[model samples]
Target: MKPVSLLLAVALGTATVVSAGPAVIECWFVEDAGGGRLSKKPSALLLRQSSESPPPRPDLDPERYLKVHDPAGTLLAAFRRYPRDAPAPRCEMSHYVPLPASAIWVSGLTPEQSCPRALDGRWLMVSMSSPVLSLSSLLRPQSEPQPEPALITVATAVLTVLTHTPTPRIRIGQDALLDLSFAYTPPTPKAATSLAPGPPPFGLEWRRQHLGKGHLMLAATPGLSGPMPAAREGAVAFAGWDDDEPLGPWTGNGTFWLPAVQPFQEGTYLATVHLPYLQGQTTLELAVQKPPKVTLTPAPLIWAAPGEAPPELLCLVSHFYPSEGLEVEWELWGGPEGRFQKAEGQRWLSALSHHSDGSVSLSAHLQPPPVTTGQHGARYACRVHHPSLPALGRSAEVTLQVAGLSGPSLEDGVGLFLSAFLLLGLINMLGWAAAYLATSEDSVEKVRHSTFLYFSLLILSPLPNSSPEGGCWLGGQNPDLEFTQTCIKSCHLKHAT
Candidate 1:
């Protein structure tokens, strides 16, 4: 008899001719017989069905095909018979001894016959409903094989293989995408051309809707351009197929795309996909951009009360991105000219921060100039430089004013006292002049001494540059012709007397 091609069951009593030429089903069992060495006994089997026309006969007798082999080149079973047109009979086998062997059935078989055989135990059973084949096995007590339906119906059970490697961290405000590549292998025979390594067209949305859940949120397109497919819920946009179309299990290189990841949504995410023969999962720890916030403040001098030591000013940088790149500076403005520097105080210091939250701060003591009078208020400032911020950087400034006892300062007070004394002397001299005008001309000589003395005091309002003793010289040089000569002559005569 020639090798036969078995037609898989499409429905209860229907047959399916593979799109490819024909179909074949195979089953095998193996065992290790002993010591480090094992039994070279026969274990594998093969079944094939024929599509050629049958010869004229009383009853239709389909040709049969079967082959069996082992490492020792042994044949366990070989036979030929006509395929049963009606529903294949149902048979059951159980309580068989466990052994180091394996049984595999492949080709266009129904779901009932496509189940995986137990890999570890003892007992073995097989139920053959079609002229094709069936098989089973056993292992240790660790795990038990679940019971499958006794009928060999349609093909089911596919394997899913997902491939994903860790990608670079995603930056904030930038577009990001998560693509999960996938493939599926149907439970068909290895020889079936349709059983290639590829994913089916199952709606990615369907998979997500059923198995998808987490804190991860999906956003609409971020307007990014690249060779990667546009992200969609049901399937990969670049898959070259519609979202809802169902593809064969063999063409398994399908990719499912998640929604775009937002900048604020940063965390580890777990993604899992379940397919017929296999299931796969991967963990993605997402990174995001967080700009730093800068603050300028003064540390407590001593709680609510002032301490012996002056207060320290601080420049605090918080919530920064790329934590390693944080930088801070302190400056003082207001002195001889409008300039600033970091050396005005006792110390220009920055405290190191080891926090994972990406926040850092700088601190230093505040020191005001010693000559605080008459000078304008001193200015304190802080500057923060970070890549996340502008090139000019961010900064803050403050002006501190120190007031003296005599108004704003002591210099103003001395000038005011001098102006008042000058006014009083001028009034006295004018009174004396008026009194002398009422008296006789000859009497003027007697009061001349008093008049000159008052006039001299008023002229002395502006201090002499050379010496305090030169004050009298200033009095004699007055621009009034009457007083310039009279006052000078009287002082000379009085000193002579």
Candidate 2:
């Protein structure tokens, strides 16, 4: 018979057709002949069934035909029957369509049922049910003659990953459960149009590489040896599709769960999926950050002289990984009630020091504004920010202590010097007037003694009190004039002697 358009509509509950428009019904019997080689042979046949045909026997011998399973693990038997004298149908090799095998394994349809209008009223129905076959069945040795190697189609596939964590990047101490969906796109648009609407078939493999450690396989079970003992806890558990437990509207999707992320899990993680004829991979980089330890140096109580700039505020951030996101913010709390404000005239100089242990230390130096006695007790805070820190960040603060000037002020020293000079000149003029009025030697000596007493009193009166009793005659209510009185009394006694 001429090659007929075999619309292989196996009876699924929904009665879906596999192909249409003059397509040959060819079956590929694949068997693994050992040594990583797959033997695939094609057999073509024409199947015809009438509405009056008897119900299919439930006990068809499974060994008479090649058994295959759909993506749902449903058993399907492919066999051919013809008269003993008839020539075998010619099998023409067509490009692999990449369609889902499940669409070809429909059930629950009878010949009496009308084919879909898209099929143009030409179709065939078959009923062959048996126990679901494992994929290993395809590798078993067949009693029939071995066929040629199967055509390996190299199609591009898209790998999509959805992480369950709140952040796109995984943090340490979090369990990383990834839902991986692998879909294969046919090489040509024509083949893509023939595919069923569902996820493609594939297997997953995980690999990781740490900074110092070499590449290691991350198995889905425990007790495997790798770079880090913590990574061995990772395992890949297959999430099979469940019609009862619907995951949104997607069907035939597969999920793989990675291990709980540990503190030591750092480096690049690669997830590769192996489709029947295609492979794809994606990578996730985990730097395994260490939270920065912020410290502000120079003590909490900083002492600075009035009208002088305060000491540099040193904000040291240590033991942090990946030095890119380090930030230091300086704030001043000095206004009424100590309101918050950014420190003015803050010139921050930063330097990053890399350690041998893959951690970085940042020293941020900020020179605060000049402070006066009025600004004493002002607080300067250094807030550090890093990727590992919380929103508020880490902070260290210091209170300003504006100290008084160490020595006498210029104005005070000048006033004291001028006062002493005028007092000495007046004493000289008085002594000269007294000596000129009394020409006697005793009178001159008395004037000279009075002059010496007056100068002595002036010199001693201005000195601060350092006596054990903490008392001084110059501390009287009228100290400026009381010293003159004391000096006069001493001078009179000296002159009488």
Candidate 3:
């Protein structure tokens, strides 16, 4: 038969193979397999009125061979031939025959021999009745069924997306499940497939041709990409601690009571968490989470004075939360160990004060002097007692000073006059020193001492609470011994000086 085509139109607008009749058909020539899905090929026939003649036929070239199973399942046709009445058998060989459009059927053309010779295309021309029909029939169209995406859809895409599943951040060491949903579907049910990259990868073999480009194609719309391009990175770090030592992974338990991480100690951890990557790059950041804040207050400072006496100056020193497995008991301290004492005739001090909540405090007074110290000084403080709180230990200390009395001469006589002269002279000296030093660049300026300083100096040093210098104490006396003699003379005179 000639290699020419007839009125073959693609009813579905697909680029169909050339056919021989006026029917616009999308066709496939399937080899009869014993069982399983029938696979088809791309070539089609363009039959003509001139092709009704009989001719020699050709044999199939499979490793194992059998004729196409008959449509009726009765007698299978081993091979096909062309009409001899048509143009001469092509290249001395043939795979199919053509019949006039008017013919209703064609015969199997049984041979005279039981074991007939195997057919080769070179022998003769043959004829057949065409099976192809017009395009307006039941054949499906070849157009894509998915949404007609704009070309700008590709350019404006900010992120790689899938129509079926949630947008997932690609991460290493993670398992990703993607749904196959983007496809051009027909009203009738059908299946399609795609193959991604390779380790041993998915390849394109359904159409019997290897892909020759950067990416392979599939029969679906809005395609998805394979793994991201970056190398897989796995890492981990310390989040924080609970008390003093670093905490473990369970640190974030109970809505994260403690910190989830530490100060970032060095170590490696593998987590299967989702993370975003730069486009076309496969990299996700694996960093530590900030640990929660776990703080604890130190135990309270509720203590009292020494001895069995409870301290008086006690208050709740403070409060704090206890760490795990530890319980706190607020207490009061009193008695001899706390320096508690009973006043000579007053009611006994409460051993400890109790709050309704079970917390306690001491109730003891530490007057100026102990019973042995004779109440002679003002080194006094209040103490507290608590059943569970600490014992007083010590009191806030005070310094005592015994003031020396002045003499009669200091009150109205020569000693007073002399002391006055000494103070005036000292003032004159300070003024002179200020005048002199104010103009000196290399020296620090002198500040005048207050009169109180002079008085304190006279009392503490000049007389030293015992000596009579500066006339603090007096007799009818000499300035040197005035302060000492003053009190003595006053007593003899019936009123203190």
Candidate 4:
């Protein structure tokens, strides 16, 4: 059987460059030889420059020509050679082949330009053809004619660039979704050309090889986690790709579930995507936040004397993340009508203190207005607001009571009664002394004087409202002062008779 030759020519170009950094170039190859017996002949070549004289073609020797490395197993696996007997055998291979600096020096390429730029129009040509027949040709008769080896070129491919756009800020423990977009110029006739005629170069196998290298990856500097392959389960999973046109812009949307981020995990991370011609990466910042613990001072209840100044209400917010955006609101409930309203008073906030664990604490003070009798049983509430808290925030409530407002209690009434009884007894003793002095002269005059003094004392002395008339008398009329009434009644009756 006659052996068929398959030639593939690929042109590589630099795609995405990071902050004036050097650009990287990648190449992939796919070949199909119509199920012909595979050959072990030198099958690949890399031409670095265009010379007036024909450039030398070297084999795809990893030690000399191309240093082939595929950290991602998908690349080499998609391009492995198949058995000769396999129907419609196809092979694919992709690699990151860096041109040696010595090669660039020998080519006299300027250092200012990247390797891909220096070898912009060069070609990576691969040939898959059976070996020449040496022993079989010798056995044939000298008269019989031998077919000449044909040099056929299959298809030509122009280089394409891949790029990733910058991602937005992500919150801790949030499900982050990244939209990855890539753009590349279409293949131009002048960019690449075929040397002969054969089969098409890029087909299903070529598409597989292209996709094998197009994987999104995430990594952190402080080692948040192991290298996370975006396509893996429980990590970043791509929904799908939008590539309507082969030569136009394309996009891949992926969802990454971030682990619960701690305070130490707050920082910038790198998201990268590898493609055939570019390694694109962008930075993603992770924000961490902790909810605040709220407490109000002078809690439960506050006692305000009638003529004294109102006490200060304090609200303490502690153990919160981010020192800013904290708010404290004061509310008052219970007036004559028992209506709830925002408390307007002198309000001030203390300077924020930052902790080593990245938490913040602060105190807010509210000086209430002068307390009044109407404000008794009023409740003061301190409500705290923060980004990490709920919309209504956390709150603490306290009740205010105005002293000297309610009339004297049972204890005060009892004390007043005892004091009044002692005063009345002292007045009676003085009256008896005066009567005794008068009685030294006449008994009738002394009795009359004593009755008059007792009546006078009763009229002049202030007393509690223990009787039906709301005042105590020198008779047994008030039930609360029965003992005093009984002792004074006999004296009162003698004086009346």
Candidate 5:
């Protein structure tokens, strides 16, 4: 006999143990030749051997064996026969248990072969209807040994997360794209593959969406780009995977997107994303805004109607939200040429326009100069414009009055008073002439007196300067001629008296 065993099963040589634990199916059985030629006949015959050991057979298939099922729950399969050279059996199918030390086969030939097995479990010896392992008669472990399907190649149940790290927070008006992935082990997953129970990177719309949604819109292509819209009210909902209706006990998580906007304002904002399979969420931040603008109007003291007198002007002012700096100034045009005049009792020539509504405002008055008297239809007005740039402000106008009063002439008073002076001088001249005529006893005395008065009288009106020889004189010489004539006339009058 020789050491015979299955093709891949373990084998034993001469002097191996007589009793051993359940053996792997052996293809070759070692048996004594008994001086007979080999027999090769394929026949259907079933046999069971309740022996302590398996008899060796060279005719069996390597590593192939049959199982025997009993009405009870016991299971049995073939094992390698020991002794390196055990006697072979001639039957096709035989059930056996090796016990009683080396005693295995207990056909009716040897009741001494019946025995018990090692490992303490009872096995029935019977011919099987089907192959147990390669065939379908036997059932393997059913329920998973752990939560997920895992191989026991390694001793420990180590699980490395073989998916993308959780997603990050997304911002408003921003088309930032993110790729989710991971490297794990039992061995790391291959590239671009995801777990069957959860989403691939592109599952949730809130994390990503259709082209231009109410908020955080999608791109023309798969990722964010191409005319995307900003998020509204800054909100969004996150969930892993599609088609997760009512999300059963399967797997994953739900997340929320807090508000996010672009062109950030000067404040704080928040955001969230859901990992359905992981049963959790992620967060992010953002800020948003725009700038401010401003404007003006004018009112001057006086504004003339198209034809009426110019009315004084009035004014007002205001500003816009987030107002910047204020620029202000004024100008006067298309009006009477007059110096600016203040009212008798006012400090500021202009009044400020008042808006209780909190606006910027201001105004002034122009005192028109006197217009020509009796001059009709004099046209005059003043236009005070503000830096109301881009447009001309309202104007203040003034109308000149032409009607006036008439008074006494210059000569009326001057002529009356001048004539009175001439009359008084003439009366004095006559009085002196008459007194001379009345008092004169001698001609010489009367002439002297008359000449003096006549010369004095002539001096009343402007006359040429007098001299003695060829020109006139102040003394009683030629001056005596008029004086003598006057005396003779006056003397005759006195004689008549």
Candidate 6:
């Protein structure tokens, strides 16, 4: 194929100059991958200007561009500079080729950067018929469709770029000669089924080849047209890197992201940028997805006896994304105070497994301590992490309750003993009441003294509802004591009747 430098000479208006000066032209060859998609990298060609002398311009204009013409005088490709005075600028360039032989009809796009205020660059997308020499066409009649001749059949310089700012403008040129050597590759098979599409990766590549010191000749194959160069250097830019020119790749580093946007939204987003010079633009299609679901199932804990060994508490985390960004943690919370802590040590074990449906499962096992002073009731939590989750992680909790333990039974025994003692005290009080009734015939002062002694004994006893009323009687003034004694006498009379 003819080198693109010959095309740049006409595109940059450098053909008229006696000595082509400093310029940089980077050409990218792209093949159509169908369905509005282009191959990740160019298959056929890459043209890059040598970094020599005359440093590149720090600033760029929207007026810079490259234009190409075919041998038959037909406009083939055009690259124009985009205006970028604002914080971000948008620029677009495209090429179209109609080749009926290879059955490849598709448009190619370059990776775009939206915030391209830093650098100036261009993208040249060239498409033509592959399998260039189709021998079967010569035997077939002209009635049917025939493949169009290649734009540049033989190696020749097509473009010559000149730097404008520097005094001796550096001339960037390329001269290529087709070796007539072809390597055909079979097409790869596509998958029958596919899940939701994700953000597609975009890439670009450029390369240059150095031929030997002697000049190369273009082969005279029929149906080929163009002014052939007398020597190899004239056909292409043979100038290599000299000490005076800067060294490095044609395009520089780059980074891109949509403004005020989220990656979760499903749609195509365009980002165009230039490092030091323009390479191209990129479009990404983000797929909308739902966050993974987290469910926890804990192992049952049963207690049959007071001193039985503690049981194993199992926690299962289910329904999580399996793409390697998941973190599962097990935590234990216990006691009436509800203090929580991470589950650790040799007794706690955890494992993560992948399912056939692309989801993940996590299982955590732990042995709880025996019914100690504070570990009676406990809860276990499973936390699952995924990129789609809104928070750090989604969690599920399970409470563990043990039954039929001796701790509550020991409490009930203490309560029963207290109840028996209270019943015994009430019987003793009844006997004292009978003895007082039999001694009621004594003199008033003597009965008062004796009754006081008996009542004081009753007050000291552990009788329910007796101590407070007896103490009040003993401590009351004369009038208060007389009122209580009268009321008691009336109660005795009613009992005798």
Clash number by candidate, in order: 32, 8, 88, 1, 54, 46
Q: Regarding lDDT, does 4 or 6 come out ahead? A: 4
What TM-score would candidate 6 get against the native?
0.27
Candidate 4: list runs displaced more than 4 Å. 1-260, 263-270, 278-285, 336-338, 404-497
Across 352-408, the per-residue lDDT of candidate 6 in tens digits comes to: 676654455666565645544354566667776766665767877665555543255
Give me the runs in candidate 1 sitting further than 4 Å from their true place: 1-168, 183-264, 293-312, 316-497
**Candidate order, lDDT descending:** 2, 4, 1, 6, 5, 3
Candidate 4, residue 105: Cα displacement in angstroms equals 23
lDDT of 2: 0.45
Clashing pairs in 4: 79-92
TM-score of each: 0.27, 0.37, 0.15, 0.35, 0.17, 0.27
Best candidate (score: lDDT) = 2
Candidate 5 lDDT by residue in tens digits, 1-497: 11243212222321232243233322222233467644433222111233433334344331223222111111211222222343332222221222322111111112333321211222111122111111111111112222212121111111111111122333223333222211111111221123343223322223332223223322111111233334444544443432232211112233333443333221221122211111111222222221111121222122233334333323222321112232223333222433443222111333334333223344333333333343233333333333322354343333333333224348777988899989998767676675555466677777566555644555564224433322333434454556556644544344335
lDDT of 2 by residue, 1-497 (tens): 11131122234411322221111234444456799997655533222222432223223222222222122212112112222343332232212221111211111111124322322211111121112100111111133422323211111112222221112345545556544433232222332211444333234455667866755444221112223223345555563333321111112233434555554566656655443323344445555566888888787678888778888878788877667787788888883345788887656555778776567787878887678776777788889888888899899888888786345559889999999999888866765554343333455466556555545544644434435533233445555545654544544344435
* Cα TM-score of candidate 5: 0.17
lDDT of 4 by residue, 367-445 (tens): 9888778888888898988777789989888888898665676989999999999988988787666445433546656
Deviation in Å, model 4, residue 381 alpha carbon: 1.6
Q: What is model 6's C-alpha RMSD?
A: 24.3
Please list the residue runs of candidate 6 whose C-alpha ends up more than 4 Å from where it truly belongs after superposition: 1-103, 107-281, 285-293, 298-309, 334-338, 345-356, 402-497
Evaluate model 5: give its lDDT: 0.29
| TM match of model 3 to true structure | 0.15
